[model samples]
Target: MSARQARIVHISIERNWREVYDFAAKPENMALWASGLGSGLEADGENWVAHGPLGSVRVKFAPENDFGVMDHIVTMASGLEVHNALRVVPNGDGAEVMFTLLRLPDVSEEQFEADFRWVLKDLNTLKKRLET
Candidate 1:
């Protein structure tokens, strides 16, 4: 079987890049905006876990840095790791947030499209929460 191509979904937020990055960089704040992670995050030793729609999943976030990189890896209980490459780049006085969604080997085109929609919704939610 051929591998599926990854896709990127992004949104522009009317907020300072640093403000958006600060809010997103913190793992604990995910549930506030991300519906998929609405169950929130819990510390589990070196890793973090969240009860997502799929089930309890482990979350590993990129270390804090000056750059607006808030990438994270969500490992499902079944051991499938979904890498979410999220970035907050400066756009004038606001910011542009982008997320790269990788299509897993077993995912069908329909499912991949649905995932893209979900990410877009989440990014919109993030924007609303920050801009308000």
Candidate 2:
């Protein structure tokens, strides 16, 4: 199935982009702010296994880089893959974090909106954690 629908949920953190990226890019640290991974992540060969809000899933993340990209793909128990594009960009003295939320096939508008809010809440959680 094709995922043509998209929404970007973003937040501005009062911290350096590099610092934000450094912390958020680590899979083990995601559970601290990213509620979906509240159970945390553990190494599973090339990917990480997270017993998240969506049940157990395999996550493949992009290699660490200087460009502040935190992209990752989550593979569900049924092998449904969802690509998540996340980025931390410089915003004056602070940082802007963005997450692209895709409304996959058969997702209703209400569910998509809820997903958008969920992403925003997660970003805000990150902001609160880092800005402290």
Candidate 3:
């Protein structure tokens, strides 16, 4: 299976890139904007766990950095892993948040479109949470 489709969504937030990155990089603040994660993630030893429509999921994020990279790996209940490469970069006075969405080999076209929409929604949610 090789869907091999990729998409990137970016939103401009009225805040410093560092501030946006700091807030977005926190797992405890995920569910506040990321609807896919539902309510929130709870620390479970070295990994973070969350229960949502897809059931229990484990997530691991990249270590703290200065370049505003916020990549993360998500392990679904079904044992599937999704790698998300997210970034926050300065744009003049504010910042731009970007999320790269990948369509897995087994994902249908409809589901892929839905995922893009969800990513857009989540990015908007993040923008609102940080800009306000």
CA lDDT of every candidate: 0.89, 0.93, 0.91
Candidate 3: residue 84 lDDT (0-100): 92
lDDT of 2 by residue, 5-79 (tens): 899898999999999999999998999989887589999999999997799999999999999999999998998
Clashing pairs in 2: none
Question: Which parts of model 2 are misplaced by more than 4 Å?
Answer: 1-3
Off by over 4 Å in 3: 1-3
User: Which candidate leads in TM-score?
Assistant: 2
Candidate 3 clashes: the total is: 0
Q: In model 2, which range of ten residues has the least summed lDDT?
A: 1-10
Better of 2 and 3 by lDDT: 2
What TM-score quantifies how close candidate 2 is to the native fold? 0.96
Per-candidate TM vs. native? 0.94, 0.96, 0.94
lDDT of 1 by residue, 1-132 (tens): 675598889899999999999998888898988889857999998789888787899988999988899888989988988888899999999999999888888789999999899989989989989988
**Candidate 2 or 1, higher TM-score:** 2
Give model 1's TM-score versus the native structure: 0.94
